[model samples]
Each structure stands twice: as C-alpha cells, then as structure tokens.
Target: MKLLLASSLALATVLGGGASAQTPPTRDPAQIQAGTYAVDPGHTQVGWRVSHMGFSNYAGGFSDVSGTLDLQPKTPATSKLSIKIPVASVTTTSDKLTGELKGDQWLDAGKFPEMTFVSTKVTPEGKDKAKVAGNLTLHGVTKPVTLDVTLVGAGVNPLNKKVTVGFEATGTLKRSEFGVKTYVPLIGDDLHLTIAGAFERQD
Candidate 1:
C-alpha cells in the first residue's frame, strides 16, 4: 500500500510539472499589427434619417460604399478613416421618393456621383468610444463633421483566421450646407447618419 501511494504521488508530480512546462496561450500576431484594412461591403452599411414634412422621419440607405481604414488596435486614438459613397446608390422603398432623390432637386446623382469623408483626427472618449473629426464633401461642398464612434469589437474570423474589426459611428449634417436644400421647412434640414462597417485586415 505504501509503494502504491508513492507511485501515485510520483505520477501526480510528473503531470503537474508537464502542465506547467506548456507555453502560455498567446494572441494572434496579425491582430496586434492592426494595419490598413478595407471595408467588407457584404458586412457594412450606411444609413440615414431625415424628417419628412416636419411630421415623421424618413429613413434610407446607400449601397456601393468603398472605404479604407487605418487602425492601430493598441492605439485606437491614432486611427484614421476615409470613405466614399456613390450618390447614385441611394435607395428608398418608395419608388417616387427614390427617383426624386436622384433628381436635380436632391442628390442629383448624375452631376455629383460621390460623397466622401476623410478623418482628420480621432479623440478617445472611453474604452470603446471615440470622437472622429473629419471633412465631409457632399453635393460639391465640403464641411467639417464630427462623428461619435464606438468600437463594436474585433477578433479573428473563425473561418479564414483573418483579423476583422467592427465599428459604429453616428453624425449629423445640415442639408442646406451641402447644397441639398430642396424644401426648407417641409423637409427637415438635419440629416442624421449612422455607419456600421466591418473591416478585414489586408496582408
């Protein structure tokens, strides 16, 4: 019985030492790099809301957005973003409204094909929040805009083993300032924009 007990103790000691000998789990190196990344259109969307006739709000979205994001996961305050949304990609459920939005009175898609935003600075507000200051160009006019940005989170893509980051940002723009002044009181001058984007790290 004593020999058996000694044998069990020796086995336990060997197992415990083996467990301690193993290397500690480490995070992905690619995640640490956090370089320039491209927007995955399939996983990104740009949405906007504006008042209609001063009574209700009308919501719409724009497809065909392209962008580049410069990220430093460890230093999010230094990150940068630049995105372009084609005016012609605007869509509404109402066919009439959709046509009108693409006409001369509104976006005038034919004349101005794109709206762009370029970030100038990023200020950290909290652990997952930031204030992004940028220049937004729309309808041939450029104006400074501020967006409240929140980092949704980031991780490795299980299927591809690539690093991906998600973010949510919101901002407001005055239509009149961008030459989108069609109806002064009828349509609200304030346009609220929400952006959700997922960026995939590039090799």
Candidate 2:
C-alpha cells in the first residue's frame, strides 16, 4: 500500500507541474498579430435563439462552419471577414424539431443549402471591441446586419502550437426580412444570433 501511494503521489505531481506550466491566452489587443487566418471549424460555432409561443426561448446551433479573416491589427478598419454556414448542419435538442426547421415550412434547407456573411465595414469600438457591418445572405435573401464583436483571446494553442485568436459576436434580425415568415408572431419573427469564432494564423 505504501508503494502504491508513492506512485500515485509522483503521478499527481507530474500532472500538476504540467498544468502549471501551460500558458494562458492574453486579452490585450496589442499582443495580437496581424495575418490572414482560416476558421478552425472544430472550434467555431454559430448559435441562435427564438421565442416559442411566448413561453420559452428555443435554442439551436450550426456546426461545420468555414470562414476567413484578414486581420490588420495596425489598421483595424482594413480587417475583413467572411463566413459560410451550412443550413443542413443546424441542430437542436429534439431531432424532430431540427428536421422540421430544415423543411420547406421553415428554413427550407434543401432549396438554400448555405447562409453566408461578408463584412463590408469594420468600426473599432474600443481597444478590444468592434462593430462589424456585413451583408448576410440566408434563404435566398440578402440583408445588411451589424454585429457587436469582442475579442476573446489571442495565444498559441498548446496542442497545435499555432497562433490563434477568438471572438464572440451577437446580433439580432427579423426572420420576416429574410423571407422566412412562417409562423410569424406565434413562432417569433425576431431571431438572435451568437457566434463563437476561432481562427488560426496561416503562413
């Protein structure tokens, strides 16, 4: 029993030492490096929320996202962003409801397989925040929208050893404006979007 306890203690010390050596990300914008970055689809996600009959807010998300970010830390206004999301990748708690959302009555994913956004203007709000105005194309309709974005972190990924940056953005839009006026008031016309974006620098 004493030998076993010594081995366990040695293992714990090694693990604790390794964890303590791991570097954390920096929040300062000055530490960010300017470069073109490709979306890390495995770490990126877009989530949405809508009201359900005035009782609860229904939540869902989309995976398999692809995007590019041309970052210009020196001239923040010159930064550009583009993102594409597969409509068929939408997910919800209920598989049945998820299927229904992709059907003709709702998003009509079969007819419109993807939604995209291209940033036209990037206005810096402060040191680590920005207002991104872009054209959003969804369900064969295009509309201008603006999202308030904040920098999450900038650091070298411990596993990949690549420099990465992350951001979170929030925006709201009316579904009816995008020609998705299905159940209008009852199902909620306003849709709120939250995006968690992760981009890795490319050579």
Across 1-203, the per-residue lDDT of candidate 1 in tens digits comes to: 99999999999999888767754322332344579998888788999999999778999999888899998767877889999999998999899999999999999999999999999999988667889999999999999999999877676665566777788999999999999999876889999999998888898
Off by over 4 Å in 2: 1-4
lDDT of 2 by residue, 1-203 (tens): 99999999999999989778987898787788999999999999999999999999999999999999999877889999999999999999999999998999888999999999999999999888999999999999999999999999998998888999999999999999999998889998999999999999998
Tell me, by lDDT, which candidate is best. Answer: 2
TM-scores, all candidates, are 0.82, 0.94
Candidate 2 root-mean-square deviation in Å: 1.4
RMSD of 1: 9.9
Scored by TM-score, the top model is 2
Q: Where does candidate 1 stray beyond 4 Å?
A: 1-33
